[model samples]
Target: MKLTVVGGGSTYTPELVDGFARLRDTLPIEELVLVDPAADRLELVGGLARRIFARQGHTGRIVTTSDLDAGVDGADAVLLQLRVGGQAAREKDETWPLECGCIGQETTGAGGLAKALRTVPVVLDIAERVRRANPRAWIIDFTNPVGIVTRALLRAGHRAVGLCNVAIGFQRKFAALLDTAPAEVHLAHVGLNHLTWETGVRLGGPDGADVLPALLAEHGEAIAADVRLPRPLLESLGVVPSYYLRYYYAHDEVVRELRTKPSRAAEVAAMERELLAMYGDPALDEKPALLAKRGGAFYSEAAVDLAAALLGGGGSPYQVVNTLNRGTLPFLPDDAVIEVQAAVGPDGPVPLPVPALDPLFSGLIANVTAYEDLALDAALRGGRDRVFRALLAHPLIGQYAYADALTDRLVAHNREHLAWA
Candidate 1:
């Protein structure tokens, strides 16, 4: 099979290359293309990718290019991981929102909305190109604001599925805690992308008995620590919230903390410099250890599994993915994209039925879903009022003053990215 990775210049590419090398038997790729506009960074990352593949004795040919059309032409799948504005823009996204006393994050608040507006149009253009190149090629989006981007792709009628490593990361961590194989542990993953909860942890498969309570009872403190949430909250809710939830659950505290520390974008920029330097070393044939600190844990495994399943290659029948709800959560609109455990195959992800949700989680999910709708609106059809309305809809920035201030800041920081501005 052939696969194309747009934004393959990202520091995260090595981790993905390592996974492709290690899991070669699972996917059996014959041609791999890395597409990026930044030629210098592409050369560094592409060299490392080739070495990683060769070091593992994999026969797949690795190619690099700046042409999206040539990279995606006739490929079995195209993976989107591009950051529209790079780390400098991300620094703005991470800093400006904090001025409004809202948590500064890339995928969760006004900052996330800014990123959505900048990213959706670029991704749509790329998807259209991919579709023209190979109508059968599946588009797997790993970009930030995945739900919004995936929704944009689906609404445009592209053959696409969104991929996130959060579920797989949780699966691996939970398996280690339970002393079981990763495949034997299944998560009742729910809610929207980046805003999800592990409602249940089942063993064997989706049909297996739920063991979430047992895991929580024994390891509540550890689990809470991992996500930086209070142990008491987990005990009370009977579910584990993703780390991103910390921004919502402790908004003021997170804002205070963010104000004191350097932006995550700054730290990642430094890390990328070091990673690129490492990639330049001819002797470095494998993924460096520092790459782990760069994040996207278990992304390679998730990508390989999803791609294999989508392309008729043999793999698990069920996996967690971001796809349309289609009534999986009775509370969400049918078109709302959600991350949940679903059966995977050549036909794509079919979301499984979720058990009845407690009002606590369901209410938040519904609220965020509404905000996402407004955010997508602002992304597709740009205007100051639309931007202000989307910010006002967000639970974290519901106050009018903050929304007004954030809307202005978002536009000012991202004017170059927003064509209508």
Candidate 2:
């Protein structure tokens, strides 16, 4: 199979390459293309990718190019990891929102809306080109604000599925804590991308017994600490929440903490420079340990498995993915993209049956889904009012004062990206 990575210049590429190199049997790639306009980073990442493959004794031909159409042409799958405006824009996304006394995050809140506006247009153009190049190719999106991006892709009639490392990372974490293999721990992972909760931790398979309560009783404090939430909160909710939920469950505390620290974007930018320098070394072949601190933990494994399953290679039957709700959650519209366990195949993911949800989680999911609906509107058809309305609708910035201020800042910081501005 020929697989192309559109944002292969990213520092995250090496980790993905490492996964592809390590799991060749799972997604036996014959031709791997790295497509990015940033020629320098692409060259560095591409060279390292080849070395990783050769080091592992894999014979896949690695190609790098700046041409999107040329790179995606005739490819079976394309992975979108592009970051519009790069880390500098992300720095703005993470910092400016904090000025409004909101948590500064790249994938949620006002910043997330800004990213969605900037990203959706670029991704749509790429998807259009990919469709023209190879109509049958599947698009696996690993972009931030994945639900919005995936929604945009599906709405545009692209063959796509959103991928996130959160579920796989949680699976691995829960497995280690439970003294079992990652595949043995099945998370009742639900909700929208980055807004999900592990309602149940089942074992064996989807039909396996739910061990969530027992796991909580045994390792509740550890899991809560790992997620940076209070142990009592987990006990009360009886489900493990995504770490991103901290921006909601502990908004003010998170805002205060965020204000005191250098933005994560800044740290990642510095780390990228260092990593690129390391990538320039001809002798370095394996993915560096520093990449672990760069985030997207287990991204490689998840990508391989998802790609494998989607392409009819080989993967676990029921894995967590972001796809259309299709009535999995009665509260959500069928078109709403939700993250949950599904049986994936060449036809794409078909979500497994999800039991009725508690209103506590369902209410938040519904609220965020509405915000995402508006966010996508603002993304696809730009307007200041629409942006402000989306921000106002967000639970994080429901107050008019913050929403108005955030809308102005978002537009100002991202004027170059927003054609309407």
Candidate 3:
């Protein structure tokens, strides 16, 4: 099978290449294309990708190009990981929102909405190109604001499934804690992308016994620390919230923390510089250890699994992915895209039935789903009012004063990216 990675110039590409090399038997890729507009970074990342494959003794041909259409043409699958405005835009996304006393984040709050607006149109255009180049190809989106992007793709009738490393990272962590293999653990990952909770941790398979209580009893403090949440909250709620929830559960505190620290974008920019330097080293074949500090942990495994399953390679039967709710959660609209456990195959992900959600989680999920709907509308049809409405709908920035201020700042900082502005 052939696979193309749009935005393959990203520093994260090496991690993905490493996974593709190690999991070659699972996916068996014959041709791999790395598409990026930034020619310099593409050369650096592409060279490292080739070396990684060579070092691993994998014979797949690795190709690099600035041409999107040529990169995607006739490929079996296209993976989207592009950042529309790069780290500079992300720095603005992470910093400006803090001025409004909201947590500064790339995929949540007003910052997330800004990213959604900038990203959705670009992703759709790329998807359209991919569809035209190879109609049967599956689109696996690893881009931020994944739920919104994936929904846009599906709504446009593209064969697509959104991939996130959160579930796989959690699975690996829970397995290590439980002293089991990663495949032996399955998470009842529920809620929208980034905003999700591990409601159940089953072993063996989907129907396996739930070990979440045991996990909490054993690793509650550590898990809470990892997510920056209080251990008592996990015990009280009987579920583990994704780290993104910190922006909600402790909004003011997070805002204060964000204000004190340099934006994550700044730190990542520095890290990318170092990573690219490392990629330039001809002797460096394996993925550098520093890449782990750059997020998207276990992304390679998740991408390989999702792609293999989608391309008719028999791999894991069930995996966590972002797809249409289709009533998996009775509270969410069927069209709402949600991150959850599902049975994976060439037919696409069929979201498994989730047990009844507690009002606590369900309420937040519903609220965010509504906000995402407005966010998508604003993304597709640009206007200040649509932007204002989406910001106001967000639980983190519900106040009129903050929403108004954020809307103005978002539009101002992103005017170049927003055509209507």
Candidate 4:
């Protein structure tokens, strides 16, 4: 089995690799390929994954390369984890939104729009390459702005699935809060990609609804207090929510704070510099002890684990991922790709169904449509006006006329950076 990891130099590469290494018995891997433009980091990770595989007595060929064609050729599955550009570009993605006086966050609102604009073309380009090279290969995408990127590939007509650890990770957290086994707790999720609510969680069978109301009522305050956001969402729906709770649950407060404070873009950039300083060069004289403190498990564990499962068809129910708006959210438009609970096999992914969404949750689902519509429109038309309309139409931004003005300023200031046509 050939598994190709596109963004093999990513900070998360180690975790993903470890995930496969630990699950070797479940899904034996035959060959692992790490592909990244940066040869130095690729070498480091390639050596590391090989060492781990050897330690586990797995006989898989590990190859690292900068060549896209070489990396993807004859591969059964390709895990795309590219950042398009990396953290430096992410700073610009965030900063551009703030300059326009809109809430300057990385994954949503104007920032997400900017990212979609820059990322869609690159993702589509890669997908097309893979399609031409290997017509039946499954593209397992792990990039951020996952929904946007996945939809771009799907619309462009490719075999792709979006994956995220956030939903599964948070589900475990909610299980702990409910004092139940993670597998015992069944869930139904809705909305777009990272931004979504767990519309339902049940303790056992189809009758899982019985446990939801009490679970939410009991943990409501704790969940809200933990994130410092009014997380009435899951509670209102009688379930638990996850992923960027601090932002969505209290969008009002977060929005207000962004308005009152100086843009944190520079501060965030500085922080990124510090992180890169610590990790960018392993040979640097003073590697942060904290860096060493990070276990090898996080290094190459998760990606490898997923790779093994996808390749070997591990029978165990891993929270493998797929992107489709069809089943998990029948209420939403069919093309809206959402990261939801998926059962993976040698064939591909089988998505579980999304439960009925509440009116507010349903509205949030519709809100995301505006963004996707504009993004798909931009990609098809090669223009930014649709993106501008997308920004103004976002439920959060459209609520304020001032936000609209700020968006205008943001586009103008970052016109060159946005590379808008």
The 0-to-1 C-alpha lDDT of every candidate, in the order given, reads 0.93, 0.95, 0.94, 0.65
Q: What TM-score goes with each of the models?
A: 0.99, 0.99, 0.99, 0.83
Off by over 4 Å in 4: 178-181, 204-210, 231-234, 256-312, 315-322, 327-330, 399-420
RMSD, every candidate, angstroms:
0.7, 0.7, 0.7, 4.2
- Candidate 1, 328-403: lDDT as tens digits: 9988889999999899899889999998999988899999999999999999999999999999999999999999
| Residue 23 displacement in candidate 2 (angstroms) | 0.7
lDDT of 4: 0.65
Q: Lowest lDDT 10-mer window, candidate 4?
A: 291-300
Flag the better candidate by TM-score, 1 or 4. Answer: 1
What ranges in model 2 sit over 4 Å off?
none
Report clashes for each candidate as comma-separated counts. 0, 0, 0, 20
> Per lDDT, what order, best first?
2, 3, 1, 4
Candidate number that wins on lDDT, 3 or 4: 3
Q: Residue 367's C-alpha lDDT in candidate 2?
A: 100
How big is the positional error of residue 73 in model 3, measured in Å on the Cα after superposition? 0.5
lDDT (Cα, tens digit) per residue for candidate 3, span 214-250: 9999999989998999999999999999998888898
Residue 358 lDDT, candidate 3, scale 0-100: 88
